[model samples]
Target: MATFYGGVPLVTEPIKTPRYDFVRAPIDQVNTQIKNDLLYSVSNLPVVGQTAAEQRVNKDVARQLLAKVYLRTNEPALAEAQCDAIINSGKYSLVNARYGVKAGSPGDYFSDMFFKGNQRRSQGNKEAIWVLENENPSIIVNGSSGSPQQRRVWGGGYHNINGMIPADSLGGRGLSRIRLNNWVLYKLYPQGDMRNSKYSIHRQHYFNNTASKYNSIKGLPVPYGQDKQYTLSDGTTVNIAKSDTLAKINPYTLKWGQFDPNDVFGFGMWKDFILMRLGETYLLKAEAQVKQGNTSGAAASINVLRTRAQAPQVSASQMTLDFVLDERARELLAEENRREELVRTKTLLQRVAAHNTDGPSQRQIVGLTANNLLLPIPLNEIQLNSQAVLEQNPGY
Candidate 1:
């Protein structure tokens, strides 16, 4: 049964006491870190009325997160109180940028404030509320590489003269491998999608991690309709003799259409990883609404998010927990770490078993108890102070 006061399930004795000093200390450390993070070391330090807006807002978020932890630990009143604190803050907002678009208008912001590159901007920024710092990869990653370099964009190999591979990529004359997953090349493209144009094909299908032939044949722009030597997607023919000499050879040995748009490390590098933006916050609120028995309210909230992705909104007639889970999976792909999320929701292990039936992660987690819900307290905490922690958790 749901613990109404805590808004969480029941917590047993072993989970409450926690066997290891390892367990108790980390919770204290996390709580301390969060309080510090929230207050800018001021709330607990007693420096009054000097708090920054960002620090204030961050503390509120930290409080909300703590509420989630509390709920997991079966502290419903604290969880609800924490949720209400942020909800009542009147500081944060749920905004839909596209709704304001007018005819011939330029006031539209295509951003999710919580996860986009605009979080640091001074004004009109939307979506993300708080985010941890991460660098945009560049010269910071690779040593001895020029100022433009980043780490491992396809293990680099190219020579400026005579078109040879570099010393790094098997003495880099050209790409050491001209390869693409056959599944990707053959199955992924569904027509009219740019991803097909973005992917590559293997050169000779000869070896692992290395291509057998050149791939630039497609990229060399020639007279329109002149690349008749190779099969075209549209089945058009061309006059090879009239085509530019540069157009005849594909630059890739076996890799086709796999060039990086950024041209980092001699190939395309994926630049951005947008995480925990407004979309997720919408989902979170929706989940909370459904949990509270307000189904229509949950559906209405979720629709706002769907409209942005240009995906169809969840119909009230079909709104269900399963649908929400699937929607979460679909929308959060590649952004949120599904592993941790599944565990927290107490749904991942079962879902994995249903899909793979016998996967290792599924089996391992099947035996996990409530204690596994939280992160482990590191071993170092046990050594420093005997009372700092009383015992290690079962898994540890």
Candidate 2:
């Protein structure tokens, strides 16, 4: 409701190196080179061919970065203008047409968020303006095995080990932590909501004898309440001995189908998480406009997205910063980019604590600072360089 500054929100801290500053003499110069390298990852965009695609990315990046800097620097109009450019560019739209439609059931919501098939190119993956080229889509989950191909496509990997199991290192090191916010669970409406149905659940009957059309059925688990473990064709044990977090599973992932009703983790947690989309951009632009005294403009922007989400339209009277903030939290949950969004909006700690009061406070927390704007910075640079002691991010 009230606006405040000097806060950073973080679900996880970035890795910090001891030495912290190697690779190049001028940081700006090094960053320019790094930017060039990032552009080369996409195949459709010419790494060496025409520069138009690069130009497109650059424009989008510049517009976003400008708002980020300006918002933090007190140049509201500049930030507003840049956001407008992104919104009106028409290159992207916040509305995800396919996912937003009413399937007349909660199942559709679950399918949209976690279903591997829903994320493919045909499903209006057009929302993803920038696609990270995954040579192989392999990912690791709380002490689970993964393969590159299946994780990326239809066969995602999941862990249905009892409940929320901790990752090996965290658990081995005795740092057990696997709990979901009850509020989040309640809001998820796991009952009839289709999205909730896709999560990890214990369906013993179908699980014990899953008939997969793909490789082998050995990896899937047997029905729950049984003590023994099953091994997959890959030789990984189906039931882990110790787990940190337990999943009701039914309301937690994109996995859905009529099974024996045993607990399982699905394909596993390997697929790439799409962090940015035109939808969030639309929301951000609208919020910026609201902050800059453009109530009408802000209303239009927010409604464009709400319309797509299938939620009711919001008028100018309801265009408070608090409303926008909560709307974003609900709309963009689990996107992995919300942390940065809260930070850029300059209200991370306050908003997070206000909503998730159980976490650590701002200063007491680690891995956030004014300078550490862009994450994904290489650790090697920190290890090789010495200035890192003063410049390395707060929580490494």
Candidate 3:
């Protein structure tokens, strides 16, 4: 609540009746309350191994959240302390080797953690601190609360292509509601980063429909470049360069891809969501370290993830706040909310203008200013509290 809006009403106890006239507390007060609550949770919550329920929250979860709160409140030392506690607890570790259900399959270790059978702690994901379990509705009643659109939003609409059909290899049918920008797709990662491997980010598409003459014995590569054309087996040319940029042939993240044979339309994704993990903890620690002018320590923290990913290691000279943000994008693209991270660091406006201004004119970010840092409080919320004068954010 304090992240998006500077201040919010602090309601500690449940209200049996509707109440108005409540005023927004100061931002510091809100942070203090959050810290107190999380400190209590850290002291009282059970350790990781004691709980049989994989979905339950533990002390490490509280510590991670508290670390994030500390970072937001400019308490870098406190944030680093929380991260140290979690790291030293020995409850979690980064997944370095291939040890999931698809261990023998053709996939990298970084991508294996995201597979359905490999998400839970019981299923070899040592990095997973919190996972929201989801079950197939056909098998269990009330299995999923609602249909999740993550797969459709993150995966590409490859089925819409001329000679392609929804296949298990290609992530199921997607509506392509979101398409990756040029900066992320082309220029983010170096040559040998495992996160940019084919298994992690499905950049290439193939002709899979057997009925189409364009289909090859060894799945013909679909053309992707601008104004590109391919000759079919029937000696006819198909212009695939003009395919829909948003859906038909765009690169997408494969983390949320799951193909359901029964539901080809893919209205819902019956997959577990990894809410918190140890991979992100290191990033948080690095951020806190960088804030305290310990760039060497920050570099060491980031190198742990880099060593696992086999990406190039950095020295203390290259450890800047901007570099940390870029590393966050590389590590947690679809998983983390990019806007929230930027807003918390106060780099949203500049970063957007630098990297997100490419791609199509319609899709580009525009008219962003300092006032956009905090969203304007809803008019209805202020009006509903008729008894008190609820102030709007500056320049609303």
Candidate 4:
């Protein structure tokens, strides 16, 4: 709440009676409240191995949240201490080798952790800090909260193509409601980066619909290019123009792909959502280090992930706030809430102006200003608090 809207009403206790006199607290007060609550949680919560349930929050989870709060509040040294506690705990580590349900399958270790059967710690994902388990609602009543659209939002809407079909290898059925920007697809990754591999990011689509005239090209790469044409086996010509490839054939991350043979329509995905993991702990530590002018320490912290990813090791000279954010994009794409990260780092305007201005006018991000740093408090919230004047954010 404090991160996005500065300081919101601190309702720490349950509302036993009607109250409308609540006013926004100072940002410092909010941070102190957050720290107290997290410290309480850290004291009460069990350690990682002590919890039998994988979904339950552990002490490390509280520490991670506290670390993030410290970072947002510009207490890098304190954040670094929290991060050190989690890292030195020896409870979590990065997924360096293939060890999951799909370990024998044709996929990388990074992508394997996102698979439905390979998410939890018992399922061989040692790096899973917090995983929300979801099951098929048809068999288990009230299994999921609601239909999860992660797959549809991140995966390509290739099934909309005439000669394509929903398949497990094709990331099931997706609507491509959100397409990755051109910078992510083209300029973000260097060659041989495992995170950008075909397994992690689905860059190619193949024809699988047997009923279509392009059946001859089944199990073959879809003929896609900017304004290119191809003649099918039945002499039917197909033209995939540049304008038609925004969502249909665009590249997307495979982290949210979950397919069920029983539920082909995929109204909901029955896969565990990894909320927090050790991979991000390293990034948080690096951010804190960079803030304290410990560039060498930050480089060492980031190289832990780089070595796991098999990407080139970075040096202390290359360590910057922008570089750390880029590494976040590369390491935690599709998993991290990017807007929150940018807002927390106060780089929304600069980063968006630099990398998110491509594509059509409607698709581009525009009119963002300093005022957008903190969102306007909702009108309903202000109207409901009639007993007090709830000030709004600046320039709202």
Model 1 lowest lDDT segment of ten: 1-10
Candidate 2's TM-score reads 0.53
Q: Arrange candidates by TM-score, descending.
A: 4, 3, 2, 1
Q: Which candidate number has the best TM-score? A: 4
Query: What is the number of residue pairs that collide in model 3?
Result: 0
* TM-score list, all predictions: 0.47, 0.53, 0.95, 0.95
Error of 4 at 172 (Å): 1.1
Per residue, candidate 1 scores C-alpha lDDT tens digits across 1-396 of: 111111211222356543333223234444445434544522342211123643233555455455545544444455545555555555555444533212133222332232223343233334444543333355345322222212222222323212233332121223323222223334333343221222111121111122223243333433322433543344543234422222222222211112232452443222223333445655665556555566786788677766654455565656655556655654453345565656656676566545443323422335645555555545675565355443545566
For all candidates in order, the CA lDDT equals 0.40, 0.44, 0.88, 0.88
Clashing pairs in 4: none
lDDT of 4 by residue, 339-396 (tens): 9999999999999999977777887988899999898999998999999999999998
Better of 1 and 2 by TM-score: 2
Tens digit of lDDT per residue, candidate 2, span 35-140?
A: 3443343223332113454213444554555555555555667667767766676566443433632244344443453344344334445555443322122232
User: What TM-score does model 3 achieve against the real structure?
Assistant: 0.95
TM-score of 1: 0.47
